[model samples]
Target: MTAVIENTAGQGTNTGRSFEEIAEIIGQVEDQSRVGVCLDTCHSFAAGYDLRTPESYRQVTADFDRIIGFGRLCGMHLNDAKGELSCHLDRHAPIGDGHLGLEAFRNVLTDPRIDNIPLILETPDDTRWAAEIALLKQMAL
Candidate 1:
């Protein structure tokens, strides 16, 4: 099973806000593959891990790779946050329609490191899912 780091409100004061924290949690186990991480874009931003620009995306992902390793990245929850950065809110918004812009998504969908993993949408508007998926597909190219 994969362990997803949640926002502070969900996981309390010392939530797995950083990859280092999650790494610590993952270290206590015997079998390394027993746990993996499913990164949530919204939760991550709310937790203060910026993904708004290409540079920010690179830095944040580099931190993740350095701390947790990409081998443990099981999947991703592709979401746009209704709340602003570091707000600690769990609100989900339609892609590119909230605090997170399209550029943030462009950075993510095009990243080759996560190419083979399942990328699930957690955007609030179910009606826009198809269009959102299409937009993401275009970004990947």
Candidate 2:
């Protein structure tokens, strides 16, 4: 089972709030075959993770690698956030159309750790899914 972070309430509610807790739970399991994680970009940002800049992105991902192991990264939800960082809101925004700028997603698209996992678009604008997909592809290359 992949322990997706429940970041809607952030620190307000403590169920799967941070990667550290997730790491403490799933990442420490002796049998690692069944457990993993799905990182939601919006939830992550809302939960106080900064991925807007290249350095911050690298730092956040490096933290993930160190704490949770990149091998346990099962999925990623690629969505921009509507609220400010650590706002603890679950609002979903289109890629590059919210608080998280295009650079944030560009960093994600270019990361080699993303090659194996599925990148899910949790954006609200399904009409622009094709355009977003194209943009992400371009960014990836």
List the global CA lDDT of all models.
0.82, 0.82
Highest TM-score: which candidate? 1
Could you give candidate 1's per-residue lDDT for residues 1-141 as a string of tens digits? 555543232335656777777888788877777788888888888888899988999999999889988888888888888888988787788898888889999998888887898899888878999999999999999
TM-score of candidate 2 to 2 decimals:
0.88
Clashes of each: 0, 0
- lDDT by residue (25-94, candidate 2, tens digit) is 7756777677878888998998889999999999998988898888877788889999999888888899
Q: In candidate 1, which residue ranges exceed 4 Å CA deviation?
A: 1-11
**Using Cα atoms with residue i matched to residue i, what is each candidate's TM-score against the true structure?**
0.90, 0.88
Candidate 1 positional error at 92, Å: 0.8
The 10-residue segment of model 2 with minimum total lDDT is 1-10
Alpha carbon lDDT at 130, candidate 1: 98
RMSD of each: 2.1, 2.2
